[model samples]
Target: MAIRGYHAHLYFDPHEVGHARAVAEAAQAAFGCPVGHFHTAPVGPHPRGSVQLSLRPEQFAQFAAWASEGREGLTVFAHGLSGDDLADHTQYVIWFGTSEPLDLSIFG
Candidate 1:
């Protein structure tokens, strides 16, 4: 199936929220993507604090490249939006740093 878009969740610890915010804001300012709320606690399946950056498919490569270097030690959980949350989080994902275990039970 064709990807609809993408969501890149930048995960950070409570102490690293400031770093996460800077990365998210830089991404938004550079790519003009929509940055979601900075959650200081784990929400949904995310294992830690996170901020989501919604990006178009066309923006993925550039964003991913930029994030790989610009993330400043943050763990970025990025995936394709293909209308299947389970598969999107598992099969169609990439990571910039150490990957975290998501609560996939929420999908089932």
Candidate 2:
């Protein structure tokens, strides 16, 4: 079954901090949703500096479109919150650039 919510991880390198912020801000501005705090380094199991946005299913398609086109050179890790963490991060993900290895232990 499809999940009712989604989480998008916006990854950036330290040098690209400003670009990362721009993307997150644009997402908040466009979607009118709360974006997570920006991290300059990997927080938890993330492999790079990142920010996150959580959106309802209603907002997923719109956000996905903007994310897919607006990330510039940054990478995005998007997945559903369908209760199965492993499948959610792997099978159910959409990538805007190269996929990064996540600390999946956090999910289980």
- Indicate which candidate wins on TM-score: 1
lDDT of 2 by residue, 1-108 (tens): 779789888998899889988888888889886789889898876899989889888998998889778887789998898898788887888888898888878866
What lDDT tens digits, residue by residue, belong to model 1 across residues 26-90? Answer: 99999999989999999988999999999999999999889889888899999999999999999
Worst 10-residue stretch by lDDT in candidate 2? 99-108
- Give the root-mean-square deviation of each candidate in angstroms: 0.7, 1.6
RMSD of 1: 0.7
User: Which pairs in model 2 have colliding backbones?
Assistant: none
Runs off by more than 4 Å, candidate 2:
none
The lDDT for every candidate, in the order shown, is: 0.93, 0.86
Which 10-residue span in candidate 1 carries the lowest summed lDDT?
64-73
Best by lDDT: 1
